[model samples]
Target: MKNGAFGRDLLVKALYGSFKKLNPLDLWHNPVMFSVELGAIVLTVEFVLEALGYKKGVLWFTGWTTFWLWLTVLLSNFAESLSEIRGKARAESLKSYKTAVMAKKLREPLPDSPYDTVSSTDLRKGDLVLVEEGDIIPGDGEIVEGAALVNEAAVTGESAPVIREAGSDRNAVIGGTKVVAGRIVVKITANPGETFLDKMIGMIETAKRRKTPNERALEVLLVSLTAIFLVVVLNFRVLSEYLVRTTGRGEPASITILMALFVCLAPTTIAALLPAIGIAGMDRLFRRNVVALSGRAIEAAGDVNVLLLDKTGTITLGNRMASEFIPVGNHTFEECVHTAMIASIADETPEGKSIMELAKKTLGVRSDALPKNVKVIPFTPETKMSGVEVDGHSYRKGAFSAVKEYILRIGGTLPPELERVVGRIAMSGATPLVVVKDKEVVGVVALKDVLKEGIKARLAKLRNMGIKSIMITGDNPLTASAIAKEAGVDDFVAEAKPEDKLNLVRDLQKQGYIVAMTGDGTNDAPALAQADVAVAMNAGTQAAREAANLIDLDSDPSKLLDIVEVGKSMLITRGALTTFSIANDIAKYFVIVPSAVSPIFPHLDKLNILRLEDPYVAVLSAVIFNALIIPALTPLALKGAFYRAVAPDKLFVYNLLIYGVGGVIAPFVAIKLIYHLIEFFVG
Candidate 1:
């Protein structure tokens, strides 16, 4: 109670102080309600009665104070209007934030509804849900039953649909995908808060908070300039008072000068310049189709270096189908096809799905129905493969290393014919998965993955821009190396886990590289968060987006490069404007001071035929010159005013030359032009 009472007293005192600072008479809307007007009328009456010196009456004092007060009121009103604009923008920002928070809250607790529920709100982690032809999958999941081709472009940024089936290991199932053919059951694993969509939103929010170096530098400069402006005002006020005291008569001359000084050093230009440029730049970014969310994110994008890309969705086509199938073993090719078909029916890998599809096409058998009494083990990254069981005997299939190791443990060797087929497949950049039944070799499944179009040209462009491209993948070394070489990447990190991707990013950073990670999956989330600037596909998982610093709405790598150029140019323009403005100010001090001290420079002080104050003429001349020249140079700060596609180093040189030469020469030209105008007006 005591603390509350004390706080109330403090608040009252502060309000009282503010009231005292502002004149009450100025707050009144009616001019007649002013105390100064009443005082002036009273002075006239007092002069008539006492016949005192007119200057000693209330009229002179009241009239002078009233004029100053009216100016002060006008300035206060302007200040109030500006504050309201700021308040409105702030309120709108708050509304956006509240809406985002509400959306995020809704995403936290997932529903445990039955598998029949297809709504995202009713989905839970690890629930097997059914999806049929032309139906949208409502949650991220894996194909658990049957085979279907799905269009996942909305989630993975891939243009083509992917074929999915049971036992397709580590394949990501996205929300809002349409099954083009066949009926399938998906096992939901990523629920509301943990989903890719949620993460993407979170990444965008984080990007808004990250400050750019240019922004930070500007903030510091603004604070220092504000402090300097305050000091100058205080000094002018003190000088006015000192001059008044030195004079024998106690006149109100000091107050008039104080009013003029306040108007002079309020930093009107600075206040208007900063936010205008920032808002203009932000608007330009949006118009260019870049999702910059905030000024700070745009600035940070200028310096991104190492771009850690997700292999499946970001580099190669996420969709994989069986292009070729090579078989080997003592068993007949028909028996081999039947065993491979049965095993692939229960598997859920890109390779697995392709094999199953080829089997159905070749054998002319329906895959929608599964045989009874079959045991399935889903493929995991750690296990490197997966398989199925029938009649108490395990039929395993996976990576060559995994199959070979298992075969060795069980005291078996790859049949000579199977080894030759596997060798031929490996040479052609195809992964060979060996199928075995009861420790006897069945056949080899050759799977082919297609490369993304124009990837080579994109890498070449990066190299031309002096950026090194690196490829990292969890695929076997042989496959990864082959793909990397084909893509013409500068470096290749093969057999990498998600953690390895993160470590690589950290290592690059330690080596003084600016890292950027682009991924559309949960595994890419951690590395994206750790990168200097992370970009995620708009269709990526919520986690991946949340971890990223930028969002590519269309998931175009080319767009990222464009944003970097724009952001860098923005910083350059800011620096250029600052140099130009400050240099003009310095030159003004030299040009105006000599005229202000003309009394001390009698030789240079020449009164024209009009006989006006030489000092005033000089100040007017300089001001007129500044007004015309400043506007002419404004194009330098405006977007797209200079070079559009110049090299960075050359752009810097050009700007320095242009602004440097222009800043110096433009003022003198303005001064000469203004002098001629004054001569024409006065002569």
Candidate 2:
């Protein structure tokens, strides 16, 4: 629909490229097309002899056959060249975004360290850079200190700002995105010309892209078919002689006519469009904001039957927001909300910020500024609790067990209903944070891990396509089971560690299952590497991204569905076109075979269903049709065939009827029409 890449300049360059590809050295890699080129060269030599008075009577026939044969070869080259040109144009557009900018290089990793200003291009790996509010990130790196809200619309095309903080899975930040709010000290992970963007650009523009396994296998099949056809056509020479000796009815077939029949019967249609199909598949993924590192990775996606998805960020929103504050024991709702808000005053995490917001929205309470003589306590994996000390009193909020142990150490006892409340919350797939004032339990804050919208339907669709969905999480069995049921996953792994995730992938692969893993953390790197098809979020750590075969620019865990669909579409398009190309030979056989040998065996006239008056006209018409079909189907090759989510058996039947049967009938009608039109104009 859009032809922006086909501007005047690009079209001229592509046209020149098409002719350059006609060189024998370039054509030799494609056996099917190489044979066609050889046929064209032989015909050209015959045409030259005819023009020089060696074969004076058949000059018109030799000249037209040679002309059409050359046209056919050029059309195939043009299809492949146009596809490459469009890919190069897209790579150029992406490269334009990598402009040099000045960065503040930090002398020390501290927040208050002195810095020097330098060009971002001059920065190297392990360099620490301080980026303040509204400052652009200078390089791809991990946040070493502080937290900030970053706008990554330049890379991910998402306008919403996402949080990047030190010591978290979401700390990784890409160069060129701006820090929309707050400040952060980043330790660069990549050197000049070695960033993620640089690698992506190289992949798109490289001329030495390796063929995927499927492409190589298909080429082998096409080559075999071409060889078989060559032997059959050559043996026709002997068969023609036998017919002449036995019946004494017609003359032996000439080399020119035999070559024409071979070219027409070979699967030239699919061979011409094969390269374009693979290139277009990669381009389609790029359009969807995914960068595939290799053609093999995208092809592997189509065969994936099991999906190992992280529970956080992929199935549920990563942030666990405070939804409700429930009073336990004799505490009132107002008191519980106020105490929870005070305990979270010094907490900078998303859960803490959410608690403060919820308190304000509920009771108009603000805890932006701490009181005099206040001491902030940050949450840690060991303590599992965070709170503030002010006015000689302690206020804290954390996991029920952690907070309970703390209260007991301080000579306090929990209310009888506290365990019941915490169990109920966990069973509902929401985390319960216990709030304490001094030595007394106040209430519980319910942090709900929200399920992403439309996730259930997406998982269901994957099921219908015969893919199993498994959710991985570190939550307890109660919480994990609730979330897994709500998300409609086929299975789940609860209380999973990094090693657990890695083992799952390895075990699935051993069972002959193609597993696709989606993650965005350093802990996920091993599993991502072990999986058959690994997709990492753009916002993930450098380790995870490097281990993945495909990177989702939008950082959406659910984007695997779209990636799978694109892969399936590519495979289906190739299969459908290959089937159609082979079926098309039935029509050409009817048109050319009977007409080519009709002079030797006149009784073969009954096989000429199209009823052409002249044999030379019929042969030329078939040549014209074969050459014209390549360009006619160029758009389909570039765009790929339409795909629907259904069982493989159902899709196979549908394609058989549409492409296979349609291929046979359509060519018969087209070649017949071309014959009459040629006769009317040239007779």
Candidate 3:
């Protein structure tokens, strides 16, 4: 019932728009419809003159024929107007997500800073705003400081509350979402009317999505067919006039009959509905919680051959945590864990926090250290070590080799037991970090990042689709290989640098593969830019988001599977309809052509195989069918034709026989049936 109302509203708009767009200059852009509009006008003039007795019975059916021609043009416009209405209505509802809110603009992005109240619309890019619990986030931005539990049901259509923290990949937040818990300072990324939802609304409302290469080629073919029909209509008229002049026929063919024949011959049925088909595809993607920058990207999703997946944060749960603490030397387990907990006290990473929690749970250790006078060295990707100094003693924890070398440099002897312990933990596919106090090796902390549930099944799905999933990580070869096998990916690149990932995309492209990459780090930005289809997580850095064409709002890399299916459906839908549309013209030709020319040459009546109706009725039936067919198939155009995951050659041949051959036969029965019904009603 709701769809019915929306359809009615669009028809009302098209009724008004039809008159507004009736001008010759405006109609010129649509050459196929412009021809029909011209024919309608010329025949209407002739019908008016004949009705005034200027000529007797010269255009007996011209008035009704002209009416049908005008209606035909209006139906085509109505199909487009109705297609846009679906997304337009959704856009209006999305505006509700942009609810009015007062933003507290910070003088600087920090707590306890001066702030001023302002409307969300007044917020500008790079401006910082403080959001408290239960307040709507003013605009699209990154959390510059603090953390919050955000309700994102309006955007991602999930009811779960997501944690957004500062200085992490998941820091970005959308406007109009509420901070259900905690507080955060956000630095706006987009101004008002420039948020992600706003961009999606604009793309859907405009409906001028960029066309893929195949769609462009199909358009050229349709236009060429229209041009050929234009010539056919003109020559048919010339022959009618020449025969009348030489043979002194009873009367020249009615201008209305010629107009009807032209409308039936052209492939205007598909042309009128093509834009609607593409718009429906985009709306489908948006409904699935994925935002595509353009229609071309969605089309590319259907053709992904090689999928390059990141290991951390993509295939596994990104929060790497400390699972077990093992004593390395002759030190007691509790003593080593107590010291490890103290060294990781100021650590903000998940690994650090989990270690503190574990120590408290097992040894009942209390955190009572002083906050001042502590020298700290943070971990860097290059150094791979972190340490703190209390008084004059240094406590450190890092990779086993880094700690072992530091202790050796301080004149400490190596322990044989430490090497065996490290090897056991490494073989288990967990990160082993050595905890040290001054020059003594104390213990090893096992950090494990668990793989997400059902990831192996997701990888298997991609493999069935002929997509090769390759895992790339900076982890050691053994760890990478173990994770690769566990995840069931086809290949793995161990200890791979950002440059290696970028080079892989280039090599894949050289081998004629459509390589698609998914990443969230700033280091992945360049490779994402070079990929055929780049999908950036919604929680990724701004650089990664800017570089990617598709943004996965759910942040599940496996969403790629759904995207590919939607894309294949879009392409298949268009192909199947185009086949049916052109083939439909063949049946209409047999219905109207013989009747059109039989009046000019009596012998041509034999070509009318069915011989079921008068020439006037047959022409009227065909014209009415042309106008009615647009609405008859409007649902199919918007919803798409039936699709299956079969090879293109198989799909083409299957559709050719079904839609192509069937389209030619079905319409003949319908047109004749319609004429017989009209004849009975008039009687």
Best by lDDT: 2
**Consecutive 10-residue window with the lowest summed lDDT within model 3:** 1-10
lDDT, candidates in the order shown: 0.57, 0.88, 0.80
After superposition, which runs of candidate 1 have C-alpha atoms over 4 Å from their true positions?
1-213, 225-271, 280-296, 317-468, 482-488, 555-559, 586-590, 602-651, 670-683
Q: What would the per-residue lDDT of candidate 1 be over residues 1-683, giving only the tens digit for each residue?
A: 42231245433443443344245454342221122223334433544543454434344333433343333333333332222232233233323322211111122222232333234565678666666788777666666567888786554446677666665332445666667887776667676666545543443333233345675566566556655754664675565456456653333223322222222223222232343345445445544534544456666655555555556655678666566555566687776777777777677777788778887888788856557678887887876767788778777777777877878888987777766788777776667777777687788777765777887777776665456668777777777777777777788787888899889999999999877666766778899788776776654555676687666655554455566656656666666666565555555554554443334434434422222354444455554444344334433333433434445676667777776666656655666566667768777
Clashes of 2: 1
Model 1 has an lDDT value of 0.57
Candidate numbers, best TM-score first, in rank order:
2, 3, 1
Instruction: Count clashing residue pairs per candidate.
Output: 24, 1, 0
Clashes by residue pair, model 2: 250-600
Q: Candidate 2, which ten residues in sequence have the lowest lDDT sum?
A: 365-374
True lDDT of residue 606, candidate 3:
76
Instruction: Quote each prediction's TM-score.
Output: 0.52, 0.88, 0.78
Q: What local lDDT does model 2 show for residue 659?
A: 92
